[model samples]
Target: MVSVSRYGREMGSVFDLLGTHEPALTAALGWALGRSPELMSRFLNRLGLNGSSDVSDVAVQLETADEAGRTDIELFTSTAHVIIEAKQGWIVPGEVQLTAYAPRLDAAATSGLDTRLVTLSDSTAAWAHEVLPAEVSGVAVIHWSWDDVRDLIAEARSKVRGTERLWLDQLEDYMGAATSKRPVTDALAYCVVISNDLFGDATFRDYVVNQRVYFHPVTGGGWPTVPPNFLAFRWDNAVRQVNRVVDYEIVAHLSERFPSVADDHSAGSRPPGDAHVVYRLGPDIPLPDGGIPSGKQNLRAQRFWVLLDQLLTQPTVIEAREATKELGAT
Candidate 1:
C-alpha cells in the first residue's frame, strides 16, 4: 500500500487501489484487454490474416482458466502478428508453463501469427529480462510492471472519463509513502537502482538516449522526463573502485532500450558510451575541455552547480574544502 498521507483518507489512492486490491486490478486489466485486446489490432487486419475483414482478437487465452495456470494472460497482436504472452503474477512457471503453449502457438503459427512473449509483472518481468534462455528466440518480449501499467491506465482513464478525483487520490497516496520526492533525480530511479542491485547491476538507461525523456514520475503529476539524451548518471561515493574511469563506457550499452534517445538525439553530438561530465570533486586540471566554463554553462550544469552548493553545505566536505581553499586561492 502507498503512503496514507499522499492519497488522503477519502479514497484509497491509485497505488492503494491496485496494491491493496489486486483483484480489482486483474478485473480492470481483463476489461481493458477484452475491449482493446492485449495486442493492438488497428492495422492487424492488413497483416495477411486468413480471410479477415478487420483483424480483431486473433486469439486470446486467459491462462487462469487454462491448465497452465490462471495468472497468465496471452494476447496475439493481430496487426503485428506477434503473440503477446502477458505472463504476470509472482511465480513464473519456467519451461513447463511456456511449453504448454507450444502446441497451441504452433497451431496458430501454421495459420500465420508470429509468436512472441512479453511478461507483464514486477519482479518476474525483471527476472525474465535477465535469464531469458537462449531457447526463447525470434520473440519480442517487453516487461511492463504492475505500477507502470496501473499508472498508465489511471492517467488515461482520468482524462477521458474525468476521474480526476480518482487520479488525484492515487497520486496523493503514492507521494505520502515516497520519502524523497525531489525532482533532481528521475522518477523510478530508486526503484530501478534497487531492483537492479538486488537482481543484478543497473543498465544506466539500458540504451543510448536521444529522444526527450518527457516523463519525470518523481516530479509528481505528469511532468515529462529530462530528455533521456540530456540526463547523465555518474557515481560519487566514499568508496573507491576501478578508477571510476572503468565505469564510463555505458553509452553504447543502452542502444536497444532507448533508440529515440540513443540514436536520434545523439546523431550529431558525442558518440554513445561517453561521459558527459568529468565528475571531479574539485576543479582538477582546470577541466581540459568541454569543462564547465565560467559563464557559458548549460542550465543542467547550473543545476549541478546548485547541487554543488548543497554538496558544499555538507559540514564535512565544506570543512575539508575550507582547509584546502586558502592554499590555492588569491
Candidate 2:
C-alpha cells in the first residue's frame, strides 16, 4: 500500500526512505540548522528560547556518548547547549532514557550556558507533555514533531535565495514526505492527460513508448505527490493513448531504471543521477478514430484529469473535462 505521486515519487520512495531513518533525519536537520542562522533562530524561538545571540559558531554532532548512553543529536553554540533525542515512527522515548540526558544539560548550565533537552518523535506534543516531568534534572524540556521542523524550514525558505534556499527546499520536501504518513487507499477510476511532443523523436518512440515506461524528475516542475490510477498521453492536439499504471519506483538516478539506454538523449533531456520517479504502464488503450482533439483552444503540455469514460465518449479535450466535472457534481 505504497502512496505514489502521479507525476513524481511514490510513498516509501528513496526520498521518504532516507527521511524515515532516524540518523539520516537527524543529520539532515542538524546540517540545515547549523548552516542557516535564520532557521536556527526560528527553531530556538519555537522552543521558547528567544533572543539567542552569539550562535554564529553553532556545532552539531550525532550519536554523542557519555555515561548515560548516546544522544541522537547535540548542538553546541556560544550561548546554548541543546541535546536532541529523536525517535522515528510511533516509538516514544522512555522517561529513564530522557532523565539520563538531563545531567549533560545541567552540567552545561554551570558554565553559564542556556541548556535544554528536546525530544523529537512522530507522536503529537501531548506525549512529550505527559511523559516529561515539569523539569528534567532542572533542565527544561521541549517537544517537537517532524512537521514542526518542516514548517520552520518552509517559512525560512521564502526569506533566502541561492544555495541556502536550495538546501531548505530539499530538507522541506524530505520532512514533508516522511510526515505525510498517508494510509494507502484503493486506486481511483480517473485519468490524467499529459501533453508531450516527443512522439516526433524516434528514440522516444522506439525506446520509451515501446518499453511502456515513463520517468520524470521529482522537482523542477509541477508534479503530483500522489499518483492516480490511469495516465493519458496527448500529442499533436489529441490524446490517443490511455494506459493504466502498473507500477512505479523512485530512484536516485535515471540509470537505475534504464541502464542500457541511459545515455540515449531520445526520451527528452534527463540528466543522469537526478532523482526521478519511473512508472510502469500497462498496454495502450488506444482512443477511437483520430483520438480526442483539443477543439479551438490550444492545450500545450498541460496536465489535466478527466473521467475515464469521458475520454472514450467526448470528441474534444474541453468537452471531456467539462463532462468529467459535470459527472463529479452529480
Top candidate by TM-score: 2
Tens digits of per-residue lDDT, candidate 1, 1-330, equal: 544442333334445444433344444444454444211232232223333334353544453455644444555555333333342332233555555445545655667656544444433333445444433433444444444554554554444433434444444344332211222332111100101111012232222112212111212232221112122222221101111111111121233333433443321333423212211111111212232222222222111111232222333323323333433210
Give a tens-digit lDDT track for model 2, residues 1-330. 757653343544334545456778787787788777778888877766674644567788888998889998888877788899887643447778989888878767999988888877654454356556656778887777666777788788979998778778777766654443323332223333443334323344343367787666644666644444677776678776777877665566566666754555543665656666677888877677887887788777677677767767777877887887776521
User: Candidate 2: minimum summed lDDT over ten consecutive residues — where?
Assistant: 180-189
- Output the number of the lDDT-best candidate: 2
Clashes of each: 27, 7
User: If scored against the real structure, what TM-score would every candidate get?
Assistant: 0.34, 0.50
Question: Cα lDDT for residue 36, model 2?
Answer: 79
In model 2, what are the clashing residue pairs, if there are any?
A: 3-11, 4-10, 4-227, 5-225, 5-226, 6-226, 6-227
lDDT (Cα) of model 2: 0.67
Q: How close is candidate 2 to the true structure, as a TM-score?
A: 0.50
